[model samples]
Target: MPDTSSRIARPRLIEIIAALATGGLLTLMVLSNSMMAAHTTPLFSSLTAHGVGSVVAGIALWGVWLLRRGQAEPIAKRHIPLWAYLGGISGALTVIITSSTANSALALTGTLALGLAGQVVLALIFDVFGAMGIERRLPRKNDLIALAAIIAGTILIIFARGAS
Candidate 1:
């Protein structure tokens, strides 16, 4: 039956987590930029550390969320989305380190490789959800569009960063 009941609930949850993740990253970016502009070394360093720390902490937090939610609601044919979030953190770290080493060809190539790898991981989540036929029931035109845009933006980020 594709769990008609879950279509509403699961989408809501997926939207919520995605929003929170996006908002958290945006807020961190803004705060970090503001602090750097103000020349507040300690605050900038602390905020940067906090942002990185939050991602590491998210691995545990999301695993718990998945465990709790999966008991009643299974999305993407028993595949867990929490792992994707962890990969995202690792991907960002790879990009940061590589971008910093712009002179090194290995670093530049590695940055693109990591970013694409993370996107593929995310795509796998969507693909599984699709194969499960959950998305078919949702009819989420707006959500799909947003997903496409985000993926495109991510690709652009990888390209732009690589060239810089």
Candidate 2:
């Protein structure tokens, strides 16, 4: 086995914490969206979520701008590719799809498990091909092992849920 001394170094620990926090927040978001979808439609739930997110993001950006108004260095301007703007569309679709699945027999647990599996697969592909300006890197042995474990767990969770 590789040396494990640095496994939880400060930076890595911070990343782990951040990932955990994000996952918790995501679960809450999915639950809220699915509940709304149950009463309203999936499309409506997605639209409402996105609308609120946009307003919140806009306010955050405005606050950041105000805080940095007197900075000496100018903010660098980079041309954002059209594809970069498509994330909102993807987010909307994700909400709609997850909402529908969460309300089905799959429920939140199965839906999250499958979604995580899909995300891992796509992330691996993206990393290999350097999609969306990400650094191109081949999966290491540990990476593959982790991916396998995640996929196996996802399959077990999904099937177990279905069998119940």
Q: Each candidate's root-mean-square deviation in Å?
A: 9.4, 6.1
What would the per-residue lDDT of candidate 2 be over residues 1-164, giving only the tens digit for each residue?
54422222223678879987997998899789879978998888888888898899999999999998988886776677999989878876786688779889988777878787789878877767677755566777776886798678768866787678
* Clash pairs, model 2 backbone: none
By summed lDDT, the worst window of 10 consecutive residues in model 1 runs over: 1-10
lDDT of 2 at 67: 95
Tell me how many residue pairs clash in candidate 2: 0
For all candidates in order, the CA lDDT equals: 0.61, 0.78
Write candidate 1's Cα lDDT for 61-143 as tens digits: 99899879847664455555666547556645643554455436556546555656766676657554664333623435676
Q: How many clashes (backbone N, Cα, C below 3 Å) per candidate?
A: 0, 0
Best by TM-score: 2
